[model samples]
Target: MTSTKIIHEKKNSDMKKLLGILLSISLLLAGCSISDKNKDLSQEHLVLSTIWFQKSPEAKALFYQAFNIAKERVVEFNKEEGEKPKAVVVDLDETMIDNSPFQGKMVEEGKPYNPEFWAEWTKLSQAKATPGAKDFTLFCDSIGVEVIYLSNRLTTELEWTMRNLDSLGFAFVTPNNFLLVDETSAKEPRREKVAEQYDIILLLGDNLNDFAEVFQHRGDDWGVSVVEKYKNEFGRRFIIFPNPMYGDWEKSIYNNERGLNENEKFKLRRKAVTAF
Candidate 1:
């Protein structure tokens, strides 16, 4: 055969092989997809993202950096000095603790969140600390600053929540210091509880609510305005961790209404996205 004809045939063969490989991968992904009657496109994407986010070394490193920054600011705030005891409030899930397993099970088992499943998961008391959390909280303890946990986890879940925190060697994790969700999830009242006892120097969490009430049910305009207003406080007094799994940020789309089905929420989320 002529050299040009031979080269052309080889190129064609390579293209065919590549196409075959791509087709196989496409089919594999298709097989992974669920065909539930209540399909919402974001679930698989969120699950995969959560897995990657929780397992990645980058995530661990980011937590390390955030905690380190928190440490530095604590020192500065301490120097400023007041008789009020210094305290730092931290959120539990996705902040101090990793709850990716619960999220993973939801995707793996082809299930959506149910109170029963969530309660069971918390009761297991199996969550581990986010990287650097133990060290940071312990550092706070050594520095004479109280470490308080203010979480949206119901007050009823305290037993396992404390067990989980204790197992992870979290410092200053006591019944007196761990504030759970009460009459409201706004967390302000709980935050106020802590405020009365100590001068809250820092707040850390994955959700913005972990910081304050302004973030809860934050509509589009209000959310943007407040964030812009407190822009400087982000990494300073408000240290935030990444949470790809879930948060109030997700709830805002549906306006905190529990009545919306997955499909309806999905449609709203689609409309909510701003594309150029």
Candidate 2:
């Protein structure tokens, strides 16, 4: 055979081999993609249910400790001759109400935070009750310990919010008990309002500001410091629920806005991270 013919045959053979390898890799990756999608769907459903209804062991233990403390405080305060124990104030979203569905939609659609989306979701009145939240609130009611929901959720969502809680088995408190913030993003005023009506013995939430205004001005570092300062209140006057899926912690790492594109946010995140 001529050398030219041999070279052409060799090139053709190499090309065929490369094409076969590429096809194999493509199929493998496609399979992996499908598997990953399935896994994500399953995990999302499980997490959604867990957030809405099932309490993890850690959450249950924390709830029990807080419940006992609140119960004791109520009893002690009520023992007073005339003054009655006030109420247990709680944050609604992620504190007592499971917004996992909203979060799941965000994750699935690769969408960022948008007030309109949240407003619409809140109107759906489908958010389920967090585990132990319903029972605890009911217990507070049964014991005459008023339960108040102080939320950052807009006042426009009030009616739907109430309906959501009611549908989720959370006892509907009077309109006064639902203190939805009207406009200000700051929670100090809400806390002050609660203080006026309730003795505010116990404050429950997933964030530090839910308890005090110390970190309201300072950012994440100050928030962390404040949490450390009040570490003793963890299971006592301040009950917290775990919400790793989303919270101020995530916001601390990334700017809490939907305006930034994913790549921009990713670049920012990369800048924040470092390798030793």
Candidate 3:
């Protein structure tokens, strides 16, 4: 009876060891699978995927030019008696603030741009300032130029936007200086509103619409052509930052339709391209 019991006990111990080995192997395989899945996800192409504003050398150069242009414009505008600038006009997202983390989060979640998600993210009010923006803005403030942030963000997001800017050390002109776009999405009207009181000389932004009305609806290539037509105005009155992560350019390429599946859009994009 004792010998039989010993045999049974040895069998159970061997079975337990076998189970442990199998579990470790299964866990290792699962870890490898997750690693491969992450690699594949990272390879997915999104429009304006490059971090142009965050890491480009050209972007840094452009920021310097913008600062100089703003300084010159302020000086020129102030020359006129009682015509001093009430405020300097700047765009919010991609202009003064960096929203790359929001984009990164979307990529990680495998989700596209949704208004609800963006609205919630705005409420977080944790966006950092773009490189060189803080320094440029501080210089502007030192010279008595009030900072006005004009954004396409909804009115409901205004409080959060202001809080984000304030948290990032951005000084505001007045509560009114934070201009939220109306339902129309026409920036020309907003510019006109700013021009009424402020000696609006230099306009700073990442998109062409920030500089002129023509780029409001145009694509990046067309906007580039239009800007070339008025190259003289660039670096003088209009200062543009680099924003390759997302913009009207991508919308133009995709025909502004969010319903198109990723595969269908990629096929269409490939068809549209022609070899020179």
Which regions of candidate 1 fall more than 4 Å away from where they truly are? 1-42
Q: lDDT (0-100) at residue 30 of candidate 3? A: 100
Q: How far out, in Å, is residue 53 in model 3?
A: 4.1
lDDT of candidate 1 at residue 256, scale 0 to 100 = 69
Off by over 4 Å in 3: 1-43, 47-65, 80-86, 219-221, 256-258, 272-276
**Highest TM-score scorer:** 1
* True-vs-predicted CA distance for residue 65, candidate 2, Å: 5.5
Model 1 poorest ten-residue lDDT run: 36-45
List model 1 lDDT by residue over 1-276, tens digit each.
999999999999999999999999998777666554234443554666676777788888989999999999888887776778999999888889988888877776657788889998999999888889999988998888899998889999998998888998888867998888878777899889888889999999898878987777577563777788889999889998987678767776676678776677778878878999
Scored by CA lDDT, what does every candidate get?
0.84, 0.73, 0.75
By lDDT, who's the top model here?
A: 1
Residues 1-276, candidate 3: write the lDDT tens digits.
699999999999999999999999999999999876764454255424545555667776766776677677777765556655666678889888888778777667766678998987899999888767877778777878777788899888887888888788876635697888667676888888888888775788888787778766565464667877889877677777777677777666677777887567667667667888
Model 3 pairs in collision: none
Task: For model 2, name the residue pairs that clash.
Answer: none
lDDT score, residue 2, model 3?
100
Q: Give the TM-score of candidate 3.
A: 0.76
